[model samples]
Target chain A: MRSEELIGELTAGLRPVRRMASPARQAGLWLGLAALAVGLAVLANGLRHDLQERMLMPQEVGQWLASVLAGVLAAVAAAMLARPDRSWRWVLLPVPALIGWFGSLGWGCLADLARLGPMAGQIGTSWGCLRFILAMGVPLAAVLFWLLRHAGPVRPMPVLLLGGLASAALCSAGLSLFHHLDAAVMVLLWHGGAMLLLVLAGALLGRPLVMRRQA
Target chain B: MSRTEGEWEAWMAAAQAGDAAAYDRLLRAALPLLRAVARRRIVNPAEAEDAVQDALLTIHTLRHSYEPARPIRPWMVAICERRAIDRLRRQGRRGGRETPIDDFGETLAAPGANKGEERVAAAELRAAVAELSEPQRTALRLAKLEDLPLTEASARSGMSVGALKVATHRAMKVLRRRLGVEE
Candidate 1:
């Protein structure tokens, strides 16, 4: 159709569209829902028995703080990426936070190397930790995805990555609050592994699942 | 005829509130800019028009997402350029099986070809091609009728090779439709 004809046809039937929430507001809403989801998971699983003692450890405290920071940064990045005109710069905004998160894990691993010698016979792998992170991640991811449905993300892969990371980070932190584990290796392996998997899944599925509808 | 960014934003904001007149004004004001943007990326005038139309439609659907405080030009430009690029990509994927102009002559000369029928068909084809828009006619004449190579035709017509291809393609489409040929 010609531009004029198309414009005429479009404007002829014009109707009011309720304004979409601002990206910041949408991010806030997603964070609020994430907090609620994590709270529910905590209630169902109960806090770790020695939560006070764990909190006293610098390694544990750093890990928790990194997780929270990662979640916040990722959420903000996702919000910016949701807009079609926004540059990929927003995707990089979460990198520092993610580095902090991984740095904490690395620190914990270094500090716990001596302790690992005594527990060499027992692998620190936990099926429950994997299950818990994934379980918590699902609803949080769902909420973030739902919030972004109306957004026209030009770079779907990065947006989805940030969203997935945000959810996974929050879920990992929530799991730490409820599940007691002495091994940082378990947290690094299971929690970090789950986050990586979610990010990969988001990149693979993002365009086909989310972008196709918008396109 | 470029509207200031603030003016465009105001119009868009008002349009989002169901002001049909404001919407119409915004579209009319933006169409030429949209066309220019699309044409820069899309060589074919028809395809450029289509891209502009698509961008306008997208802007309409996503108007509510536009922050009144933000400049409208970049948003519109992004949509226009993206749509135009998408058209180019789609054309590329269709794999240039465009009917060669020589094929028309070959068809007329095939076995059991009737002279009178050929003349009539040729006349009809000529009339249809002549009726096309100037850009399409120029492309067809330079690229097909004159048997000029794309580069030479592009130089003669002062259009890019990509645009000439698009015009030729569109011209062929119109001819096919008018001649009752299956696409």
Candidate 2:
């Protein structure tokens, strides 16, 4: 259609629209819902027996805090990406927290390797962790996508990449609360692997899933 | 009249409030800016126009995302740029698989062999099929002539799907050889 004609049609169809809340506000709402979901999942799965002792260690505390922070920042980043005027730099919001997350895991891995030698690298198949993360992460991703779908994000791939990461990070943190695995290598392999899978799934499916709403 | 940045912002704010006149003015005034932004990414004039339309549609859908307090130009420009790039990518994907009508100098001839030649070919195919073994003939009839799926063909012919497939393959090969067609 001609630009002038489109203007006429759009104006004719115009309706009052309540402006969306700010990105930070949206992120907060998403995080609140996500926390509730995680809380329910933890309740069903039951908390780890060593949860109290693990909280006492500084390294464990750092990892937990970093994971939660990364999830929070990633959710904010994904929300910011929905705003057309928002700079691409919003994608970097979770980087510092992610570095901290990986750093804590690396430190733990080193400690395990020093203590257990080759036994530290003995990674077993944790189908339960995979199932847990997917169960929690997929719903969280669906909710995030629903929340941001109205924005018709211009950068859907990056938005979904961050959004998927946010969901996975939060779910992994929740997993730590219920499923006990002391070795960081095990956590990195199983939980980190699941997170990678989710991120890739989001990026691959971004154009089709998000662009459907866009069109 | 060309609108100032603040005016554009005000107009968009009004647009969100269902002010039709303000929305029309805002969209019309933004056309040239959107055009310029689209042209930066899309070299073809028609494609650039398409990008502009796409950007406008996106703007309409996401009107609520436009914060009244923020400058509108960047928001508008970003939408135009992204839409243009999206159009270019789509065009690139299509270019590989499609031949444009303009690429041809003249209209192509009518489809297929002439009527007489087609009839002769059909008769020869029928004769060849008649000469095939019973299993091959049934395979050709059920699977090829009827265009039934392998499973259905197998069920009708009382042969396994794998056997149906093999028979069909052999039948086609024999027919091709009998008709002196190339592999």
Candidate 3:
């Protein structure tokens, strides 16, 4: 049929639709879910033994702040990228936050190395931490993916990448709350590794799962 | 149809709220722009219209995603372009054989030819086409006889455009040999 005819037919029976949640609201929802997932993980594995002391320490506090900031920035980026027509500028939103996250992690790692004299023994010891982040990330990624599905991203790769990054960052922050390992090297290696894996997985799966099928 | 950005956003906002009338207006206003976008990509009018239709359907499905505060043109353009590319790809797969029927025009127009001779030539041409393989014959029928563009022919025949082109080329070569016609 002619496009004109089809347009008429399609719009003729149109019903009222509720507006989709704004990007900020969607991000907030994902963050809320992340908190719940983290709580469950903490219940399952217990919080760090020095939780109160670490929470008071500047190094730990800085790492958490940077991770949380990265998560928020990444969530915003994901929301914007979910739209096919979003400005390219939106992709840059997470850059500063990501840099800060890495910087804070590096600083924390340096402090630990100075105080504890090398993390050689702890480097690969916490495979469980990797598993924990992935376990937590799966549900977070799922919720973010659900939100993005409604957004109908045209370029699913980038959108999914951002969503995965945001999910990983949020999951990493949650891990910090539950896992007591002061070894910043472990956090960098395992938690960071999980985040990278999620982004890569998202990139690979975006076209097949996230994009709308060709008409 | 040349609405200001605010007007377009307002219409979209209303549509998002289930204002069917506003949605209708927005779509009507957007049609020409959508058509123009599709036409830029698809040479065939029918195919271009089909792309526009596909994009409009997509827009309808994704209407809620349009933030009322944002400009609507980019969203519409993106959908239109994506649909147009899909139509083009589909058409390319069908392989358009737009060979003109004019080659046989002169023979049919020969002055000395009587009805009996014309019937003989027609039968010979039909027989030649019939002798070709199924794929070749279908390609010839859709691309040459029916004068369908490649994409539409591909859609009808379930063949990739490249395969249809090869089929049509081979069919023509066979016909030329049988008819003793120059390329």
Candidate 4:
């Protein structure tokens, strides 16, 4: 089509549109809504019996903070990436937090190994963690995807990857609040694996999930 | 032309509010800049024009992503760059699979059919190339004008393959800019 004709068609079709909220603001909204949903899920499942004591432990605190930070940062990154002008470095926002999360998990695993010899990293039947992540993570992811869908991310892979990470990380953090599994290796394997799976799922669904709806 | 402070930003803000005149003004003003950026990567005029149109359409659809408070040029440039890259990739893929239906053999057999035009273009290119830096000139001569392999170019130029590639890329940019195809 000729440039003039296209410009005419576009200008003729113009309609008022609500500007997309800033990435930080949208992420904040997602964080708030996600926190509320996860909190409700935790409440329904009931908090861990030793929640107060676990909160006092350095490793436990570190793990919780790391999970929360990773989730929040990933959500922010996902939101930021919806804009074409945003730097790719925004996608790396969650790296430090993820490192902290892994460090905490490794520290716990090492402590267990020192204490329980070969029995420390036992793989148990904790399918509940997987179930929890899917149950809670899916809805959180759906909400995030819905929020970002309108913006139509230029490169959807990283946005979806970060969104998935945000959802899973938040769910895992919530899981620690309620679920009473003390096996670091089990939590790392199950929880971390669940997060990885969610991220992969999001990435695979990238193009479809964030594509702008055709008129 | 000089613009008033935040003129484009104000126009974009108005465009979001469904002001067609403001939107038209913004699009018209942005067209040349978008075209220039597209032409930087897409040498073919038709493909570059398509890239520019694609970018404008993208800007229309994703207008809501524009923040009125921010500078508009970077956002527009990024979209244009993405469209240009997409066109280049599409061209590359199609180039590998498709052949031209119109064979040039008959045309080439005709005496001096396009010779005058070709000479004019070649002279223009040479003039532009002569203004390039020494490294850039050599890189263009070896890698592009002579169509030599990078290894051969590197061997002849005493520059690393990586350096030769950079020099060639910079040379192309200079040539494009000098030829008034790109900014």
Candidate 5:
């Protein structure tokens, strides 16, 4: 063996690690399944209610919901690619499916917005401008993430960039739904702020494992 | 050859129960890996050899400090680092000022099988780390590399907790960007 390998073997010594008990892990499995069920129920009810309220405008509903769901899916994929947890892989299943579901709904919404005639032209002007900026910024950040090709498991810059991208997408999606008079400022401060919050939540969740990790 | 985990655990139990022969066997088993660590950190072959020896001796002296209930790796690591640091200090004082040998614990495995893949990973990480301003680099080296706590690093580096936090954050950001973690 190489000298370094030999040394590594020696230092490994007779130190056998103590693995965690299996039953405790099983309880966590059940809990996660329960959570996933809850999420599905909430989504189902919300969708049913929204559909009933919006008459039969299929195209507009599909557009608005599809884009939001797609953005979520993109974020989830980005996260999984960044960190793949075997136990968490199950969470990935519904995410993409939900995105597909939402995308279809969102398509209708986008169509509805597009049809809001020249009489309500300012709505188009503002939403269109904001949407364009958001669309450009979000995808640009995602592309930058791909380009960066970060060599490690977790790094600050990539995470921040991912956060920025997610934030832009989230802000745009929120503004698309609720056009407060100051839509731009609302998206920038409130929506952008919430996205940053989510990013911090993700980092916080991953910290213990990442922090203890050897470089 | 791979030993079963049961056999390894049994050996550990025996060593923990004060079986002298089992303890000796354990130390000897780890010799190769310990030497590898020393070789990687120490520049001179002779110094590396001596450093490993001293580290082994410390391991023997502090064998009881290894809690039988816990994994033995960290205990061994702690001893190895302490000895390595002493050697670095002795040598450093001779040359005016010295760098700590505890700057790195283990070299990371590279991802690809390209001939220079491992060397390249090391080079890239080293370059990224080196690119940090002295304070950021120092904080990173202390906290992540040496695995020291923020408070201990603060005492050693004389940077306040807030300043150290900023340095570590910036350093982590640079490393992340370089590695493409955000992407």
Candidate 6:
């Protein structure tokens, strides 16, 4: 009898045709882990490379502490590997927070990475090594925020792998870019690249670890 | 006296365990689910009601297949979605199958684009809903979106059951006309 009634009936009957959970969160952790392990390897290995040398600065003690922390972190990486299996966004936000904590802890090591004293300092007039150190940690912290909002479902592997590829390409370009600059600039890219890569890798790899726990 | 998360989880655990009371409560808890499911597919009020009852009966028969540990909403969703789809299919709209033409937008006579036009075609169907007569548009929208039953709509609209049926039929006809959708 009425057009309005008919409209109401049709409108009432509709249901969502889809129910699958978003796949990106899991994939994000998977890729994040791969990148994280590689980054840790780079940092731990770089620290080890620097470990044998004798001279110790008051600030250098902080770097040494960093290396020790990295060792402990590496030892327990298997235990930390449980963030990605979540089908929800809320679970994944903790990843960046964890990385940021370590970065904040490394503020001392970063603040002094540029002051090479005599010979090393002779290569440049006041290397901005600290800037690079902070730069390395900042992008990842920022990216974590991007991830909290879910930056358009980047599979964690692709994101980290892309970061790796981008960093490698940037490194070649960076060598040329930093040739006239100082070791500080190089260190900036090196650690920053590693930091960004490792966090992404952890985010990716953590997914499966989490899923294993869930299972 | 308060039902905390622990209590809810414990209730689920008990239901999981062979507690008859838990199973009954769980069944009762799903009363809303039947309404949610039935209200989606069939446009007629009485038909929607009958479909819901039949689905619940089926759920009873299939309850043994329900695993204790897995999430339950998805299980309920699967049943509801299928029952709704089935009712729609039986109403002579055919079933949800792939359309021909492969590309609706690509047929737009574009320059060198390699992608097909199927996405455009699917979108067009949704848009066509608005072009129908007022009654038909309402019926289709309510049935497909709000998931309301036909009888409930009938009461709300003050239209007789037969009149409502005609409105939906006409609405579908108009959508087919606008989109070149075949019977």
Enumerate the candidates' DockQ scores in order. Answer: 0.41, 0.45, 0.32, 0.41, 0.01, 0.01
Candidate 3 or 6, higher TM-score? Answer: 3
Provide the DockQ value for model 5: 0.01
Give me the displacement of residue B67 in model 6, in angstroms. 17
Tell me the tens digit of each residue's lDDT in model 4 across A105-203.
Answer: 988888888876675347677888888898788778877887887445256677888999999999999999999887788889999988888878777
For candidate 3, write residues A1-215 as lDDT tens digits: 66667767777787777777787788788878777877787778777778899988886787788888888788888877777677758878988878888887887788888888877855766777678767777667766876777444355666777888887888788777777666777788888988898777766665455555422
- Using TM-score as the measure, name the better of candidate 1 and candidate 4: 4
Ranking by TM-score: 4, 2, 1, 3, 5, 6
Tell me the TM-score of candidate 3's A chain: 0.85
For model 2, how does the per-residue alpha-carbon lDDT over B40-113 read when each residue is reduced to its tens digit? Answer: 88777888999999999889988987889889999999988889988988999898896556534445565543
Better of 3 and 6 by lDDT: 3
For B31-76, candidate 1 gives per-residue lDDT tens digits of 8899899989876677778888778877876677777877888778
Colliding pairs, model 4: none
lDDT of 5 by residue, A1-215 (tens): 34344334444454533332232232233224323433443344343334444435564455446445544544444443332111234235335544554455444345445555332342323444354334434433433243222212223333433434443444445444434332223333444444454445434443333333221
lDDT of 1 by residue, A77-110 (tens): 8987777677768888878877887887776666
Residue lDDT tens for model 5, B1-183:
235334444555576455555655666666666777777777766677777777765554334323344456554555565566667778877876544455444444554434466788889999888889999999898888898989999999999989999999999999999977883
Q: Each candidate: how many clashes?
A: 1, 0, 6, 0, 40, 52
> Alpha-carbon error at B147 in model 4, in Å?
42
Q: For candidate 2, lDDT tens digit of each residue in A1-215?
A: 78889889989978998988888899999999999999899999899999999999988999999999999999999999988899999989899999999988888888888887875355677888888888789878877877777544487777888999999999999999999887788999899999998888777765555666532
Q: After superposition, how far is residue B165 of candidate 3 from its true place, in Å?
A: 60
Q: What is the TM-score of chain B alone in each candidate?
A: 0.52, 0.52, 0.52, 0.53, 0.45, 0.39
Q: Which lDDT tens digits does candidate 4 get at residues B48-120? A: 9999999998999889878877789888898899889989989998997875544444455568765877888
Candidate 3 docking classification: acceptable
Model 6 CAPRI quality: incorrect
- Kindly provide the TM-score of model 1 when superposed on the true structure, using C-alpha atoms: 0.72
Give me candidate 3's TM-score against the actual structure.
0.67
lDDT of candidate 4 at residue A122, scale 0 to 100: 75
The TM-scores, one per candidate, come to: 0.72, 0.74, 0.67, 0.77, 0.28, 0.27
